[model samples]
Each structure stands twice: as structure tokens, then as C-alpha cells.
Target: MGLLLSGVLVWQASNAAFVGVTSNANNSWSAGTVNLTNDSGGTPMFHVTQMVPGQSGSRCIEITSASSVPVDVKFYTDVTALPVDDIRPYIDITVEDGTGGTFASCAGFTPSGGTEFTGTLQNLTTTRTTYANGLGPWALDGTPPDKLSFRISWQFHADAPPVAQAGSTPNVAFIWEAQS
Candidate 1:
């Protein structure tokens, strides 16, 4: 009876979508609708590629928030040959608003009313040290690509319009670090 109960609990937990206070696929920003370009400053360097969701190569996601608080973002990858321990990867989430503005210029997207993730990307990016405990959610900072669940989100102003639309929406291009 004890063993059976334990197994059942483990199975149930795996099915639970909400983990680490961050949820998956909730308020998703449709791919291929985002606009890709160099930020106004142009000091920070990055690249973008167009890919259909669930198509060949890797699928990329861009999300915009309609809420006042910052939602923790996460990305889980398809099956891979390397173990989570041996790999190193990060995602550069260029969060934009409904009006097609970058996070930098958008004042309403500021993060609030959320606990700072202990291993959040902000800490890692500032420290500039690679190879932390194990592969978890980290902010994109142009590191070597690895098998990783790319997770990134930022707070958006409540009045911001929708950044992604269904079939005929304009999308943005961002470099998925997991790939070259």
C-alpha cells in the first residue's frame, strides 16, 4: 500500500502543469508574429530566425504579459542525447509589448509583486559565472547553446495590447541559444 501510494503521488506531480510558481504555455505569445530587429541602442548583440511552431529545427516562443506582475517564464526542450548536468544553455528573451516596443522602453512592463527566483537569470547574468549547480531557468546572455528548457518572461503594463495573434499575426525573430 505504501509503495503504491508513493508511485501515485509521483505520477500525479509529474502531470501537474504549475511548478515553481511558474506555469507553462499560459499566456503564450504566438511564434512568427514577433518583429525582429536590433534594439534602438544596438550595443547588445543578438540574432533571430523564423521557425514555425512544432516544425523542424527548434520551436521558439515569445510571450507578453497583460498583468502587472512579472510572470516567471520557463522553456522545456525536446528529448536530447546529453544529460541536464553536462549541458549549458540560456535564452535571450527580448520581451516586447503590444505596441511593438522593447522591454527597455516600456515602463508598464516592470516586474513587481513577485519573489525573486534564487537561481533566476538576473543573478547569473550579473555574476558572469557559467556552470552553476544544474541546468535550470537562466536569462539569455549569449552563452554557448545547450539542451535546456528556455524560460524567460517580464512584467508588462496592463494597457499593453496583444503582441501575438493567431494565424495572420506578425511575429518577431530571436536567436534560440539552444541552436547555433
Candidate 2:
């Protein structure tokens, strides 16, 4: 009996020694973020003074992504104040995707095929449209070079009726938003 007990004990010890061991390794994950900014130096992206009939003006605005992930970009405008004399109808505004331009100049800028928007400033301000979509999968440090430049142009129509009053839109706000 003693001998059998000893053999049993030895077999149990050997089986225990041969057993495999395992431990859990923990891990965690988090989602990235999306951010967009207007690269224009400061306020008043488009500022024109003394606009007259048959006269045109343009301004360049640069946009960049500082996102950690991919994002879609969109544009919006708000007419904070309108001309008191209702001169909006006589003004023609156009937006174009531009390249190789600075905020102060659109020299060497290549227009993206056609105009993105063409209408009176008052009308454009009421609507929010997609200026550029599916922009990029920008990295945290804005990798892949996610950048865009746009040109906003306006002209006082020569054929405008004589009744068009002399007025101005003092404040117009342009906004850029991003989504992942």
C-alpha cells in the first residue's frame, strides 16, 4: 500500500510540473479626432472698399486639416448684416477652388475647372453648401499635406439697373467644418 501510494504521489507531482501556465495581457484603444482651420492670417477674409460698376475684387483663403484621422470638409457663410439699400441683387459673387495663391494674392492660382458658387452674396449667405468633400485622411500632424486654397470673387455688374443703390455688406462670416 505504501509503495502504491508513493508511486501515485510521484505521478501527480510530475503531471503538475508538466502543466502549462498562461496569463492575460491587457490592451486599450481610443478613437482619433478631426480638426479644420482657415489658414488666413486674420479676420476680414474678403475686404473690398469703394466697389463700383464693372469693377471686380478677389481674395484667397487657405484651409488646412490638423486632424488625427480622416475627415470631410464643408463650407458655410452667414450674412451678418445686409446693405440697407438692398444692393445685393446687383452684386455677383463667385467662389473657385484655387491653387498657388496667398491670402493677399491669387497670382498663379489655377481655378478648379469651374465656379463653385455664383450668386448674390445675400443668397449665398442663406445656404450652407459643400465647398470640398472627402478631403483627407490627415494625420495628427496634418500628414499627407492636407491643404486647400479658395478664391472668392465679386463684381459689380455693369448692366445693373441704375436703380442699384450704393451700399455695402459690412459683415459676412465664412465658416469651415470637419467631420470624421
Candidate 3:
């Protein structure tokens, strides 16, 4: 004899599990630098043997910044020594910014970047002596050859009280400062 009694039938299917993960490694930080150079090549912008009354001249210099970050460049002056006769008051200075020029001459300097300063040499040393009162905050994009040109024009006043400025030598050094 055989038993044949069944109640209910049940069926189940196996399930598969999935997993995923991701990660980032080798994280670091660094600080960039600000570097500036000029096309002057160790040459003085101007060296006048004799500057007579009503004499005038101009020079152009290109400034380049090799900064790794964006920066603003300021222009200032460093007066080497006062003239023997204090002739700075008689000398006029006109500073401009543009392109196509060199330390030797401002023949091709176009008035693109606008005038920076217009005053006497004495005022330049006294008033605009520091970066805070400097001529420019020229913006540079941090490119390797971010360049800006400056044209400095000077003149000796003609309508003067016949004051002789013979052997009166005043030296002024133009400077550029770059900051973030």
C-alpha cells in the first residue's frame, strides 16, 4: 500500500545582490607665486647728458608678469637723489600706458591704456611715492607673458624765472608692484 496525500505547493526564486563603491586619492594643495620682468634688459630708461630749458623726451617700457595667479600691478617711483638745485619742481612728468615701445624710445607707443600720471617730478616723488598712491593697478591675467607698456614723457618748463639748472641731476627709478 502507498500514501498519497498532499496539502499545498510553494515555489521561491533566489535573488542576486549587487554592490558598488568609488574613491578619490592623492589630494594636495599648493601656493602660487607672483613674478614680474621687464624688457629694459638692465638699461636705464633715460640718461640725459644735458637737459636744457624747454627740453623734452619720452621713453617706453614693457612690463611682463610670470605670475601663476591673477594680479594687479602698481607703478611707483624711487628717487635716487635730489638734484643739486632742486630742479624737480621745474621738470614735468607725464606717464602713460600702452604697447609697441621699448626702453630706448616711445616712437611706436600708442595711447591705448590711457594716461597714468600728469604732474611734476617733485609731485611724483612726494605724492605718488608708494604703491597706495602709485600710478596703476593694471590688471594681468596671470599668463606667462602678461605684458603692459608704460610711456614716460618729461619736459623742462620753458616759462621760468630764468633759473639755471646746470649740472642739476635728478634720478628717478620707476617701479612696478604686482599683487593679488
Per-model TM-score versus the true fold: 0.18, 0.73, 0.81
- Please give the CA lDDT of all the candidate structures: 0.30, 0.70, 0.81
List, residue by residue over 18-60, the lDDT tens digit for candidate 3: 5578999999999988999998998888787677778998888
Residue lDDT tens for model 2, 1-59: 99999999999987875667888788778988676777676768766777678888888
Model 3 spans > 4 angstroms off: 1-23, 167-169
Per-residue CA lDDT of candidate 1, range 1-180, in tens?
A: 999999999999889877576556656554322112233343322232332332221122223322222222232222224333321112222222122224244332333234223332233333433223222232323322211222134222223223321212112222322211
Poorly placed runs, candidate 2 (over 4 Å): 1-24, 129-144
Return whichever of 1 and 2 wins on lDDT: 2
lDDT of 2 at 66: 72
For model 2 the local lDDT of residue 179 reads 70
Instruction: Give me candidate 1's TM-score against the actual structure.
Output: 0.18
Candidate 1, overall lDDT? 0.30
Error of 3 at 50 (Å): 2.1
Better of 1 and 3 by lDDT: 3
